[model samples]
Target: MKPGLLALVCVAFLATLPPVDAFAAPAPSLPEAGYAPLKMTIGGETRCLTADGDETKSWQYVALKACEDGSRLQNWKLKSIGNARYFIFNEYFGEKRYLRTYSKASSIALDSDTSGYSTMRSWEVSNGALNDIRLWNVYSRDIGQWKTLDADPQSQSVGISIPGGTRVDVWQYGIDMPTPQFPVAGTRKILVMATHFSDETSADSAPVRDTVLGVFGTPYYEDRSARNYLMQASGERLTPNMDFLDEVDIGERPDACNASQILSAARDAARHREKNPQDYDYLFVSIRQWRQCPWVGLASVPGNWVLAQGSSAHKFWTWTHEFGHALGFHHARILYGCPPRDGVAQLGGDCTTYNYGKAPTDPMGGGGASMFPVAYQHFAGWLSDADVPWIKHDGTYKLDPLWRRGSAAQGYRIRRSDGSVLFVEFRRPSQPFETWWGASPYVSGVTVYVVNYAPKARSMTSTLVNTTPGSGRSMGDAPLLPNHSLDDTLSGMRLTVTLAHNDGAELKVEKLPK
Candidate 1:
């Protein structure tokens, strides 16, 4: 066994094994870089992907914290690794480590080795929503989900990876992103069909039809109802392109206008009317008889049906509320507990659980006076870029009534270092269709909200940073008057109402120190 003979034997044995290039030379790099000041969310909490305030720890693993848009550590860029794969690199560390997910490992970490890339370090990016995207692990092919790192007392409130169906929405920093707005020429057309109980000989569809026409159609632009406000806000009118048909009696049976028969009655009435494919955007059944108590409105169909009683109980707000669903709007308040907490349930717009409908601010909450929340406006595409301005710097600003568009800021979204947001706006309680304010007369003023943009939390996360503590009913306790302030010392953000007049309110905001 001479040295030369042994070397020749080793070379032959190595040749018998697999080639070094057999696994493929990773993936090709894409030109994606320089995008930053973004936020990563999981289960409605902002992830803290930071280097622990220690600049020397470039080798440290990335973790999730409450979102802080101001932190350079949280900013990232996805450097491509070919085959629809990418390495999510933190901008702060300059490619020192890549965010590494695993096929079997529950936690995500940072890999320091750049030369030897693993499939776990690669990700596939796909659209999550308009101008939003989701990341999938190239190895596991599972979507990225977050689990709290709370078990480690030393760990900041950040998220660690757990693979599942949850997706994160990455937003372009410092812009009031546009909400979903469809073109006006393609506005949805809906037909309103009134129905009567077979036994109720005097019920007529005229009143119901007239109400729908009056509320949703004709006077909407002038009356300043929620519908009118939406029209002014989105520039795209919600004109359901309405049509009214004669009353169709639901057959003379004891159970004739019962819960089971309403939908059928609507179907029959819809068939009885002129069939126009162009007019099929939605179908509304106005039941003329009143016997039920649940007051359940139907919205199972995406662009159809706001079936409600044709009685006196059917108010303008109620009709508008049902239309909200027809227009693809869901309940603004779902999971509810308090500001900065996960909501407990999925109650759409109903505030009975918290305040017993005493001061319902939203039409969905059974209150008529309150304007729609900013989140709803955003979802409904009611807020244009001009309506909501993103504030990354400190400033004293004037806010107009959120009900209508104005020259000043209708609303300002100030991002904190933790990635939580502050929404400041002025609310004119006397705005049209806002009659619920009479119930809590003091609600007209400047309003500030803290927004949690995670899906589970985003629904209930738009809670008011109120100036008053436990003042009115839970629904009425958000708006702040002139000279009042709501401060979040932890986030280093403070909002003060300087002047509140009919024109608008002056607000001074202090963002977190850079």
Candidate 2:
């Protein structure tokens, strides 16, 4: 502790001291830093975007960034800066909203304040010539005006309609799936639950309905079914339409342990999707190793009907409906105007009576009818108009299917419309014999346009049979339901499909009399 030694030590320590901020990287400055304000399509209509010259590459002119409904152009966080750079958003449609950011920066040059958008409209870029990258957001928004968007406010998911007898086979790859290729909306998520079906359910106790995802075995939603349903629904509601995605069935696995396996499968599927350029989307699944107690026999949702150890009918239904969630169809809100029982609105609509009263028609909303066919075929995707035609919950032109998965994800061949061959695998799942006349809003009903075909579906001759209504079991007021089954043959030379609806709608169905 000598004074001279202490002074020497202090000087040495001071010499070794680190510089104040030498090694640290400096934060971006206000002018040099970037900000990401959210842009939203209020009602799936239009979104308003604003940015300053500082943030935009075009520092001289105001930058005009174009955005689509449910489509965001940047993964940005807001940083309050100048007056021209502020954040404001609102929703016009229901509750859902989405944001997307471009992988590359889009340059939008504006001349001035009032001329911001208008001038940008005439803005040009090139090796010197003008480019034809047509977009709607170049010059639309005012300082704080609400932007108008035209993208369809509906979501273009997928739709399904299978028959009770239609066998559930794993879609083998590198093989000819040779399906109808009705353009789908978003990525398709598959949920396999084969072990939960029952043979005795017969078509009798089945519920009446429409084409949609239906479940029969293991009650409505088991751990597998419920988890899959939630994942698909969440993705649909949250993620905007992207290039690729799908859900699939898992082999026999325990319900409780299925979560991890399902997540693993989704990851694998996602990786595989990269090969197809359809890899930029979301996926969900439930792999069943064996029936675990936590997930075994659980309700698909709340009051689902598919129970464990059922028949093929139930199993088929499960696949159909759970897939529906991935496809983007919300459950029928009893309050939305469905038949209410005892004050509680029943989702499955009204039940039809049948078979002496030994059994009642299903009321869960997912179809279970043996006749009338109008029943919601849990196996059917119950496509809504918005889910079809490649529209967002808010409408917009979907070019991904046409540009990316076009030839592979879709194609059309004309076989002289003869009874010999026509009506390829429609990919539509129905109850025994059901046909969808309308488009599902949840599916990409566009993309696939057919010129002509023979009537292998027999829908031309197939009439809706009005069967006796189930007595007390009947939920709908109709004493008769529509008959969907048919076995007939017809042919035609050519057919022109104008447009396809997303709700499993058949665009062109013209055939010659047999």
Clashes of each: 16, 129
**lDDT by residue (tens digit), candidate 1, 1-514:** 0111011001000011111222112322223456465455455555545654455554566555667656767777776554234677776666877777554636566656554337567655543333344455554532323332221324433333443323233433321232222222224566666666677764665556555565444554356433344454444534446666666665554433343356665566566565442356566666654655235354421234566664631454556665654443434331223232121111112222232233244544444435666645653444544567665555688887666557797677654544445566666655345444343423456655545443211122344433453233454555666666655543455566778766777877675334
Q: Give candidate 2 misplaced runs (Cα > 4 Å).
A: 1-257, 262-314, 336-364, 369-514
Candidate with top lDDT is 1
Q: What is the lDDT of candidate 1?
A: 0.49
lDDT of 1 at 447: 58
Clashes of 2: 129
Model 1 — TM-score against the truth?
A: 0.57
Relative to the unseen true structure, what is the Cα RMSD of model 2?
24.8
